[model samples]
Every structure is written in C-alpha cells, then in structure tokens.
Target: MDGDRRIAAEIIEAVGGKENIVSAAHCATRLRIMVKDKEQIDQSKVEHIEKVKGAFFNSGQYQVILGTGTVNKIYEEVIKLGVESSSKGEQTKEAAKSGSVFQRAIRSFGDVFVPIIPALVATGLFMGVRGLVMQEKILSLFGITPDHVPDNFILFTQVLTDTAFIFLPALVAWSTFRVFGGSPIIGLVLGLMLVSPSLPNAWEVAGGQAEVIKFFGFIPVVGYQGSVLPAFIAGIVGAKLEQQIRKRVPDTFDLIVTPFLTLLVMIFLALFIIGPIFHSVEEVMLHATVAVLEWPFGISGFIIGFLNQMIVITGVHHVFNLLEIQLLEKFGNNPYNAIVTCSVAAQGGAALAVGLKTKSKKLKALALPSSLSALLGITEPAIFGVNLRYFKPFVMGLIGGGVGGFFASIFGLKGTGMAITVIPGTLLYLNGQIVLYLLVNLIAIAVAFILTWLFGFHDKMLKNQE
Candidate 1:
C-alpha cells in the first residue's frame, strides 16, 4: 500500500507536478483528471506510470485508465490530495474551472458508474443475447420467452439485470462515503433506506387522509427506487453529518457511536429530502425529452447532436433500453429509433476510414474491426481502442456523428422494432428506418473516411511497408 502511494505521488508530480492537477477522481478503472493545461501534462509520462494501463482525454477529462486491484487505493489517495490541498490554500483557480457544472455532471455520472463497467458489460451482452435468443426459433424451442421459458432462467437473468438499478443507491452511498472520508457502514445504511420497499407509499402523506398520523403529524419521506441523484445527496449529507459526529464523540466509542448517529440522520434525509428532490429532477428530464423532440428541426438537430454524445459516455445511454422496451409494451415493436443507431454507426465509420488510411499496420488492424463493431452500437472498441489512440479518426468520427445526427433529425427517419444487433441490423431488412439507417450510416462512413484521408494520419509512413 505504501509503495503504491509512493508511486502514485511520484507520477502525480511527474505529470507537471501537483500544481498542474486542477482536480482528480477515479471512475471504475480510470482516473478522471482535470489539469491546468493539457499542454503541460505529459500524457506519455502518465501512461508509463506503474500500474497505469493507458491514458487519454475524452470530452475534456484527462482519463488515466488504471487496471483492476489498485483503483480504490489510487482514488482514495487522489481524494485525500484534493482535500489536503484545499485545506492548505494551495488550490488554484484552475480547480474551479475543473469543477464546472457541465464537467462536474459528466464526472459525477462517470465516477459513480464507471467502476461497475465489467458487470454492466456482461449485463448488456446478456440482455442483447436474450433479445436475440427470444427471436431465434432454435432457442425458443428450449423455452426462453415469458410464456414458454422455464421460470428459473428468467428469474436469474432478471436478478442479474435488475441488481444495479434496484440497489443503485447503496452503491452510490458507499462510493460517495469513501470519497468523502466517511464510514462505509453508515453509507450502506443510508443508501438502503432510499431503496427500501416501504418508502413508496409514504407519498400518501401529502393527501391529508384519515389516519394520516405522520412522524410529528404528517411529514413523510418518499421512496427513491431507481433514483441516482437522491442517493448522492443523501451520501453527501451523511458524510458531513458523520464528520460532525466524529468530532463531537470521544475517541473511545468513536467507531460505534459515530456510525450509528450518521446512519440514523442520513436515513431520515434520504427518505424525506434527497429522494424526493432527485425524483423531481428525473421527471423534468423525462418530460423535457418530449418537448425537445417536438421543437423546430434545426434546434432539435443541434441539441440531439450535442446531447447524444453526452448520453453515450454516461452509460445511462442505455436508458434508451426503456424506449426499446416501449416497442414491446405498446406497439409490439419499436419504430423511430434511428437516432442512436446512426450515431453509433457514425463513430464506427469514422474509425474504419482512418484505419484504412493509417500507415501503421497494427493501428489499421485495430481501427478496421473497431469501426465494424461500432456500426452495431459498440463504441468502446472504436472510441477507446481506436479513436483515442489515433487523433484524426476521433475527430472525423465526431464530425460524422454531428452530421449524421443532424441529417437523421431533419429526415425524420424512424427505426423498426428490433433488438439492436451488430451484423444483422446493418441490412435494414424491415423498414425505411433500416434503409435510411443504412444510408445515414454510409454517409457518415464516407464523410469520416474522406476527412481522415485528407487530414493525414500520425503514422502515415509506417503502413507504406504493407
């Protein structure tokens, strides 16, 4: 542990010294850093740090993707550094810029969720496969559908897929408490309260019903199931309250009394204050989606272009899951879903174009398949494995995404109800959305390819040997 801290501290210094860091936090396997200037931060040096797997910047955060086993220690060290620096008045104005509302929002989402990417990857793959399985006659013969399938497999998959959402507050509370230097036990207690089964009906308090004897005559705490923001708020309050309790309590009973008091207060707030506030925010976003979709095309186009990328990185990008399910819920199939499909294809196209033009044989090999994979809506390979390494490809892909999103929005292309698949979905077999989906995808690919070819690759000379 000491050695790890020593190494982390050394690397922190080597990357333009501590003064260069505006703020630092970790998400899953990556360290989300904001620095005074990208120019001063030595990306190569940072990448070379012991246990550092790779380094890159995306959407303004300098991400140091660390390997497993060391993320928690590094995250803690980084947070302590942040806290201590602030205390000493060594903090710079650049830190303020790093903590902007937009940047903070992105960072919060990433930090809270990125650490759980492996489980998510598995869940996503499983869900995607399940969708395909239900559609396959051979698999259906084994009974996989709601009516036909064995109950056990369905229950198992449900548990796996729903675990994250059902217990999200618990996870958030734990992570936030760790970051804030509070007790994990207290966090767990607070988090569990938000998702507790009892809180949902607590909203009946607002109705002034008979036998409505509330705690002190009618104030009630609402449930926070499937909520993200409320858990965060509760965690923050819990941490602060824990600190206060720790300061007041004597050292002898510190461990026992501190957590007990902290948990009690946080549960109260989670049930009463934080949960309700977050629910309101979610409602706002849900309601706004419709109004925005109804707006003028040009305005909607720009917003879609901008917000789509934002949504993808946050992993909530799968909230589109609900929309896809909406097809099954209402119409038995979804239509008008071309936007995300095309957006994903744009990235793949951009990567593929650059992959072909790059002089490096190894890079080309990576880019080619990455783009192909991304066309099916898997951008991790394209974004991280390809674009992050090759600058021109990422730029072209961003351009392609913007262009494709704009045009698709203008044409009013709609998706046919189908589970998103990589290769099978590319054909546009069922509807005009699929056809236009292919067209928009092709347009993005062509534009990205042209841009990458003209811009020139960093390793242009290397591939000539092939």
Candidate 2:
C-alpha cells in the first residue's frame, strides 16, 4: 500500500507534477497521461523509478508501463493525488495524436483484422485436431484403424474446420464495417449476398463444374468463397456510402432510406466492381508472396524474420495480414506463420533472459510475465514493458528471429493456419510437422536467450532503479 503511493508520487513528480497533467488513465498495464507539454516529463527519471518497468511517449500521452495489478493500484494513488481522470474514448483521441499517418493507417488495418482473428484461430485449431486424429500412422499407433472411425464424425470435423473459412468474407466485412463506423449487420448481409447460393461458386467455375455469369461481353461473375480483399473493399465503400446517404436523407425517412440505398448500391459494387478488380489483385499478391518466400536460399525469410519486430514497433505490422490471408486462401496452409512464430518466440526469449538476469525484483516481476505472454504469441507487453526498454536485448531478439526464420525456410516449415503463432500456434503443426515446429521455436528462443544473457543484458542496467 505504501509502496504504491511512493511509486505514484515519484511518477507524478517525474512527469512535472499534477499541474502539468491534463488527464490521466490506467489501462491493464500502463498509466496513460495526457500532459500540457511534453518537455516537462523526465524520461530518464521516469524510467529510473522503481516499479516503473518502462516509459514512452505515445499518441498525445506519456505512457508509463507499471505492469497489471500494480498499475491499477498506482492509478488509484494517481487519482488520489488530484490528477483528473479521462475516459478511454478521450484517451483514444489523445492517442490518435502520436502515431504518424502511415502508422495510423496500418494500425487501422490491424484493428479491423484483430476482431476476426479468434474465429480463424479456432478454425485452424479444429483443422489441426482433425488432421492429428485422422492420420493413418497416428491411428495405427493408437490401435485404431481409419475404418473404425464413423463416417459422420469425419463430416462433423469438416463442419468445425470449414465453416469459419467458408464464411470468411462475412467476418472480414463485418469487422471492416465496424472499424469504418458502418452498420456491421448490413456489412455482414452484403458480404453474404456476395456468396449467395444464387451465384456460381468460384472454385466450381474455375474447375469447369459451373458456368460463369457475365453481365456484359467482358465481365464474368462468380461467388466469392474463401475471399478477403473484395470483402474488405466492399466494407469500406459500403460504410462511407451509408454515412453519405444518412446525411442526405431527412430525419423522417432516414432509417429506411439510408440502409436501402446503401445496400442497393454496395451489392452491385461488391459483385461487379470490387470483386473482380480486387480478386485479381489478390491473386497477383499471392503469387508475389509465394515467389519471395521461395527466393533462393531462404533470403526472404531471413529478412522478414529480422524485420518483423521492427515493423511492430513502427505500428505497421498489420500490413502483413493480407499476405497471410492470401497464403491461406491459395494454399490452404500458411508458411508465413513459420517465419512469424520465430520472430515472436525470439521476443519471448529475450524477455525471459532479462527476467532471469535482472537483479531488481520489480524489473524481474515485469519481465518474467511479459516473457510468458510473448512465448504464448502476444509480444506487445514483452516488447514495450521489457525488451525495448533495454536496447541491446531487442536487437539480439531480432537476430535470433532472423536465424530461426532462415532455418524455418531451409527445413520447409509451414503451418495449417493463420493469426496464431508461437505456443498456441502449435495446433497448426499438429498434422505431421509438430517436431519441426518445435525445433524452429526452440532455435528462436534459445538463440535469443543466449544472446541476450551473454551480451545484451546485465544486472547493472537496473542498479540505478533499485
């Protein structure tokens, strides 16, 4: 109790006292303070305070990472010290002030995709479990024959594994609409219209099993199944169109008129314009991604592995989502995840090394749990709360990720999924490649831990804080 107040007092003093604070709020792991002037905050002193894991300026706020439980307690102290508190919505606007335009756009892409990840991750796990249990060799080891398994059970597995992907467009569109401030339900319906049983299945049309519906002499139309870019485009257009329609329609007719015009226009654009144009573009992107990853001697993998964490720092990592989705769309498997898993695992290792080596009990507490989170495939806490706070460990992590990625490509490691990486991601490799997957992650974690322990970190780094 006393410790929280002392830390809170020091933090308030370090950031130029309560007079300079405009508003303050605490999230799960950090204290976000919007200040009147950035020059007043002491970066060094703020970081040097015990219980303060790290600090950085973001958006329009000075953010201090104080871990989870400690942050909530420290926040009470901060409020008690007479600092005004702000709502998360207001904090978001203030946060909007920090990142570059490019950074903001990239993060917007991330936001749209973030909500849809769980569905994809769950489906991937289901796919892996089915693959694991259905393998002939594995069944033999268990003294069970494939013939003994019920046929209906196989159909049930398909229901679990395929439903999410079959309706992927709806998920993508719904999320995108929400991100862009449109009615998510309308976006979902529009997306469903694109894949309506009325339209010819794209795969069947390609396989010559179904006929292509042409609107004019040149445009051929087919149902968008297992698609992404088209739905994303449709979502953006539909949302903006809906907003415009709402503005023009009078209040009396607004509710009915707005959605009717929006859907009517968007359905045509989704099928006629966005679908054909972006689908071709998606094909080109898919091919280009395959070519680069297949580049000689795994050079591309090494480069991506090394730069992945750097991209995260720039707040632009979400750009890779398209590529990942493209890989899954074309191949039914994603090799990119192999490279990403290495990158993410190395971050965990670097944080783990810091936790093991740092002498400060407070620093140790933050690093260890952050490391665990990173290992389980979430890197933000580890990166911001520990590794990046110490410069050399971050660089070492990147090196580790690069080396691991190189090996991943050399050994042809791939995953039967997207959106999940590192530990939870093991489900993707359960089919027949779990061994290789473990090896890739081991190399990543081991290299990072070794490098950071030997050269990247030391107890002296926290001696001042202690």
How many clashes in each candidate? 6, 1
Q: Clashing residue pairs, candidate 2?
A: 59-98
The per-model lDDT (C-alpha) reads 0.59, 0.86
> What tens-digit string does per-residue lDDT give for candidate 2 at 1-466?
5888988999999999999999889877789998988899999889778877778886567888877688899999999989999875578656665677876677668878877877877877887888898899989997989998988998999799777777888888998888788999999998898888899987788789999899987787889988999999999999999998988899999889988999999999988899999999988888899999998898987898999999887667788887887677667788899998999999999999999998868778888988888888878778887888777889999999998999888888878888888888999999899998999889999999999999999988765344
| C-alpha root-mean-square deviation, candidate 2 | 2.8
Error of 1 at 202 (Å): 9.1
Candidate 1 clashing pairs? 28-115, 334-417, 336-414, 336-415, 337-415, 359-463
How well is each residue in 1-466 modelled by candidate 1, as lDDT tens digits?
Answer: 5867865785677567777876676554566666667787776566446656456665555676554446667766766654222321122123323555866554444444444444434444454455545454646677554466778878887776556656766777876676555787778777887767665532233344323324555564565545566776777778888999999999999979998888777776666666656657755654565466546664564456435644765534544543343332222232334555555666677777767766756566667766766766667657766565555566676666667666767776544333353344543223323456567667666776677677735564334422
> What lDDT is obtained when candidate 1 is compared to the true structure?
0.59
Single out the weakest 10-residue window by summed lDDT for candidate 1: 83-92
